[model samples]
Target: MQPQFQSMQTTGSIAVGQNRVLRNTYLMLAVSMVPTLIGALVGIQMRFSFFAGSPLVSFLVFMGVAWGFMWGIEKNKNSGLGVALLLGFTFFMGLMLSRVLQVALGFSNGGSIIAMAAGGTAATFFVLSSIAATTKRDFSGMSSFLTVGAIVLLLAIVANIFLQIPGLYLAISAGIALLSAAWMLYDIQNIVRGGETNYVSASLSVYLNLYNLFVSLINLLMALTGQRE
Candidate 1:
């Protein structure tokens, strides 16, 4: 009876810690968005073009920088530096985003389309996060499948850069949207299930999921509903 009581107390304490981690992750995620918006606005204002030269070279450089940031964040996941790195990475991502936003804003009804995409992404995040928090089903099995899908998608993207196939572009956009949603669900659930204890790392994962989801949704909406001048 005494050992059973101790086990129950241990379980409760673990639950409390997990809840704290989840709450902190949400807080950090919200804070990170400010820098992202600022970066995007600044890039748009300056007419920044990462791909001003060769697209392939630009892409390789971007990947190298992005991966370096992610590595830094992971390495410092237990410290304040991790949060800072995550925010910085998001800002870089936002700068990358300006290219798409510039293209999106080119359409006559671009503002409305952008709003719709944002709304859709928000709704999707709400739904997925709610399910992740409330559902008892295990999402652990999704990691491997999502990883494989992402690799295939990455290869497709590189191929399309040279192939320049419109249909494949649309397909990739759709794939990204779907994959991001699934990854978000899996990540949130990992936190909820106590598999992810570091708020910084968890926030970085979730932030990327949201960022990609928003970008992919914007691309899909533009391709499907954009009105040109």
Candidate 2:
């Protein structure tokens, strides 16, 4: 009887811990958005360009820098430094987004399109998160599949950079949007099920999911509906 009671207590403690992590993650995710917004606004005004001469080189450099930041954030996830690094990474991502935003804004209804993309992305996140939180279904099986899909998508994106095929570009954008949504669900479920115990890492995962979702949605929308200026 005493052993059973101890097991119950252990389970209860884990539940409480998971709840705290989830709450903190949501708070940090919200706070992270402010810096991203600021970065995007400044990026648009300044017309930031990573490298004007070579798109492929710029992309490779950007990926290297992004990976470096992710490694730093993971290494410092237990400290305050992790939060700072995460915010800095989001700011850099916003700056990276400016080029796409600039392109979207070149259309006659660019603002509307951007708003729609944001709204759609938010809807996707809210729906997926809700399902993950409320449902008892385990999404653990998706982890491996999604990881493979992401790798393939990344390779496709890199290839299209040189191929410059419009059809493939559209397909890649759609694939990213789908994968981002799935990842949001998986990440949230992982948090809820005590699979992920760290708020910092969880917040980073969710933020990246939302970031990719927004970017992909915007690309799809602009490609299909954008009215050129």
Candidate 3:
């Protein structure tokens, strides 16, 4: 009887810890948005376009900086520096996203497409996050599969810099949106199941998933709705 009681207690304690982690992750996720907004506004105002002459050059530069920022954030995850780094990374991402915004704003229905995409993304996030928070089923098994899919997709995207295939670019954008949505579910579940104990890392993972999803959705909308002046 004592052993049974102890096991139950341990399980309860773990559940509580996971709830706390999820709560903190959520709070930090909300806080990180300010920086993103600031970055977007600044970049747009500055007419920031990365390596306009070479998409490949821009892609490499962006990826290098993004990964470097993520590394720094992880290494400092336990300190105040982690918070700063995470905000910095989000700001950089927002700046990167501004190019898409710039192009989208050029379209007649650009504003409409952007609004639809944002609303759709919010709806998707809400549904997936709710499932992660309330569902009892474990989803960790999908992590390996999702990781492989993401890597393959990334390579394809990188290759497209030179290939410049419109069809392939559309496929990759659609794939990324789907994968990142799935990843958001997985990451949220990891927090719910106690697989992710650090809010810093957890927030970073979710932030990236959301950011990627946003970018992919924007790309899809642009492809569908963009018209020149």
Candidate 4:
């Protein structure tokens, strides 16, 4: 009876720890968005264009920088520097995002389309996150499949840089949106199940998921409903 009681205590403690981590992760995720919004506004005002001359070269450079930031953040995940690095990375991403927003704003109904995409993304996040929090099923098993899908999507994106196929671009956007939603579910469940204990790392994972989902949704919405001025 003592042994069983001890086991129950341990489980309860772990659940508390996981809940704390999830709470902190959510707080950090919300805070990180402030820098992202600032960066996007600044970029839009400056007419920032990442792919200035060569799309392929600019993309390669961007990927290198992004990975470097991720590496730094992971290496310092236990320290305050991790949070700083994560914010910086999000700012960079927001700057990149401004290009899309600029293009979207070029359409006659661009603002409405952007709003619709944002609403849809928020709805998707709410549903997936709620399921992750309440459902007892393990989603960690989906990691390997999701990783393969991400690799395939990355390869397709690189190919499209040269192919410049509009249809394939839209298809890839749809694929990314689906994958992002799946990843968010998997990631949030990891937090709920205590598989991921570090709030900093967890927030970064979820933030990336949200960013990708938003971008992909915008792309699809603009394609389907955008009206040129």
Error of 1 at 15 (Å): 0.7
Clashing pairs in 4: none
Clashing pairs in 3: none
Give RMSD to native, each candidate: 0.8, 1.1, 1.5, 0.9
1 or 2, greater by lDDT: 2
> How would you encode candidate 4's per-residue C-alpha lDDT over 1-229 as one tens digit per residue?
9999999999999999999999999999999999899889999999999998899999999999999999999999999999999999999988998999999999999999889888988899899999999987888899999999999999999999999999999999999999999999999999998999999999999999999999998999899999999
Question: In candidate 2, which residue ranges exceed 4 Å CA deviation?
Answer: none
Instruction: Note the Cα lDDT for every prediction shown.
Output: 0.93, 0.94, 0.90, 0.95
Mark the 10 consecutive residues where model 2 has the least summed lDDT: 48-57
- Give model 1's TM-score versus the native structure: 0.98
Candidate 2 lDDT over residue span 1-229, tens digit each: 9999999999999999999999999999999999898888889999987757687999899999999999999999999999999999999998988888988999999999899999998899889989999998999999999999999999998898899999999999999999999999999999999999999999999999999999999999999999987
Cα displacement (angstroms), candidate 4, residue 217, comes to 0.7
Candidate 4: Cα lDDT at 3: 100
Clashing pairs in 2: none
Candidate 3 residue-wise lDDT, 11-124, digit = tens: 999988988999999899999988888888888899998868788887888889999999999999999999999999999988988888888889988888778888888888
Model 3 deviation from the true structure expressed as Cα RMSD, one decimal place: 1.5
In candidate 4, how many Å is residue 14 off? 0.2
Evaluate model 2: give its lDDT. 0.94
